[model samples]
Every structure is written in C-alpha cells, then in structure tokens.
Target: MPKVTCHNICDAIAAAPLPDGMHTKLIGIDGCGGSGKSTLARQLAQDIGARVIPTDDFAAWDCPLEWHDRFMAQVIGPFQANQPARYQRYDWHSRTLANWITVPAGGTVIIEGVSAIRQLFRPALAYKIYVETPRAIRLARGLARDGADAWPMWQGWMAEEDAYVAAELPAKQADLVIDGTQPLAAR
Candidate 1:
C-alpha cells in the first residue's frame, strides 16, 4: 500500500524469493504515460543485468490495453517453458510490425508500459511494480519527450489509464508502488 522509498528496486527484486513456474521471472513495470515506467525498467534491467520487453513492442494502434492475451501467448508462454520468448516488434514510425525479437531464457525479464501488469500476466510475474507520478509532472514529461503535438495522445492515454485503473486497482495489487519522481537509481 505504501510507496517504495529511496531504495534500489532491482536489489529488492533480485533478493526476493521467486516461485517456480517460469524459468525466467517476469517483472511488470506499469503506469500512466510519462510516469517513468521505461526509466525504471531500464535502470532495473541494468542493475540486475536483466532484459526488458516493452508492451510498446506489441502496440498496433488498437487499444494499447488490449495486449494481455497476445502478449501472454507469444511471450509468457515460451518463457514459462524455459524457452526463448519471441514477439513481433511494432514500428511507430512505419505503423507496422518490423521484426521479431527473441528473448532468451534468463534470470529476470521486465515488462514495461501503461498496461504491462495486466491480470493475465500476474501468475508468471515474480513481482509487479507500478510507477505513480502526478499528472502535472507526467504531462510535463510527455510534452518534453514527445513535443507539444503529443498532448492529444497523452490526454487520451491518461483517460484510458484512468478507466483501466478504475476497473482494475493495479496499484493496490502491486508488489511495489514507486514514486516516479524518484528515479530507480542503480547502485
């Protein structure tokens, strides 16, 4: 229920006892747009020498939240079997699927994005992390990163995130709720 203080998330995860099911432990990093999920994922990946697969890789212009089934089948399925997980990466520039990515069996695999911690993927996750940042800060981060033209998209995403969160209390279910303003600094 409380937020993660000044601590290395990767350290916490690496030390936590993991349950057996998947050869690779999954960690979901989820939050609203510009809430620092990607930053946390990158830092955690580097900290524990793990790999990350963003839901953006599966984005197809349809509701981004609608990725649980496909992601579970394509990625989680293989990982659970101790085999490499494969996914077709979506290209935002071209608006098409560009290439297939192979994620080998490993210690930890991070899933990062708005709806990364969908209910379907929970059974395979070692832990779930939800980044919480204020709307003002998130909006500022979005404008700075995606430029002024992205406000419309960000607004729509925020609304979607709100509805999703309302329907599913992800934060309450999270193993660790992080303050996005605080970076997941590597030690």
Candidate 2:
C-alpha cells in the first residue's frame, strides 16, 4: 500500500471523477474502533468543505452493523436524489435516537466508522479510506476513552469489528490506506 499524507488524500478526492448520474461525491473512511477514523474524516472535511457524518451517530453498543437500512433511507437516498439528508443521530449516552442532523445536497460528504465502507455503501462512494492501526494501540485508545469498566463491552465490540474486517476486507477495497497511529496534519 502507498503511504499518503492527508493532503494527498484530499487532492485525490477532489480530482476523482464522479460516477454517471451522481450529483454528490461520497467518501467512506473505515477502520476499527479507536483507529483514528474520526480524526482523518474531520481533517479531510475541513480541507475539502465536506460534511462529516459518522456511523457512530447511528451505531450503538448492541447494533453494530444493522443500521444500514436507516442510513440508506435517511442519508444515501436523499443525496442520491439531490436532496438534503436529515437523519436522527443515535446518542450513545442515552442509547437512543436524538436530534436530527441535516447534510445538504451536492459536493462531498464523508461517512466514517467501522462499517462506513461496507458493501452497501460501496457503489455510491467516490473514494474509500481505511485506517490501519495495531490492535494493542486501538484497545488502549478505547480503554482510555471508554474507561476500564467498559472492558467487556470493548472486547465484544472488537470481536464484532474483527469479524467485519475479515468478511469485508475493507483495507483491501480501500483506494487509500492510512496510518492511524500518526497524526494527519492538514496542508
């Protein structure tokens, strides 16, 4: 895999040709939990004026990858029709659907999370990114953010993520694979 700076990734996105009959460019940033997918997504969004919609907003501790139908109906469907995407964010704190977030039509939009680049979203994506980080580092990050009490939950989640990775092979499907351990500085 070729190592690329965030700037290079942004440039590639900007230059990438959109598929026929598509109005908006969708980018998927996929990685395991605590793999710095959010960091990279934010940086790319800031650099390129793209909207960032994290899959975390939809996924909960129990439902890891089952929110695809809702995602397709709320976000992808609207964007595909050149309309704004309005979807409820699943607040992890309350473990329920929360406030509505709107993503305007056209231009670039990023969906970042564990299954952000799943088979369901592949056809609409103009660019795909997978963040590669060590399992030890990822677990450490998770423990730091979620606390030691959440260890069992984290373990289960990690298992689910591993199964997803094995089944999907997102890194192999990615147009660009990035180092999650390094900070992605914007140009």
- Which 10-residue window in model 2 sums to the lowest lDDT? 1-10
Model 1 vs. true fold: TM:
0.90
Model 1 per-residue lDDT tens digits across residues 1-187: 4345335575578776565856688888888888999988887787677899999888644465776777888898888888899888889778888899999986898989887777777778888998999999999998998889877777777788899888778898798888888764444
Output the worst ten-in-a-row residue range by lDDT, candidate 1: 1-10
Task: Give candidate 2's total backbone clashes.
Answer: 0
Total backbone collisions, model 1:
0
lDDT of 2 by residue, 10-47 (tens): 88999987755778899999999999998888888988
Q: Candidate 2 regions off by >4 Å?
A: 1-3, 185-187
Model 2's C-alpha root-mean-square deviation from the true structure amounts to 1.4
Residue pairs with backbone atoms closer than 3 Å in model 1 (clashes): none
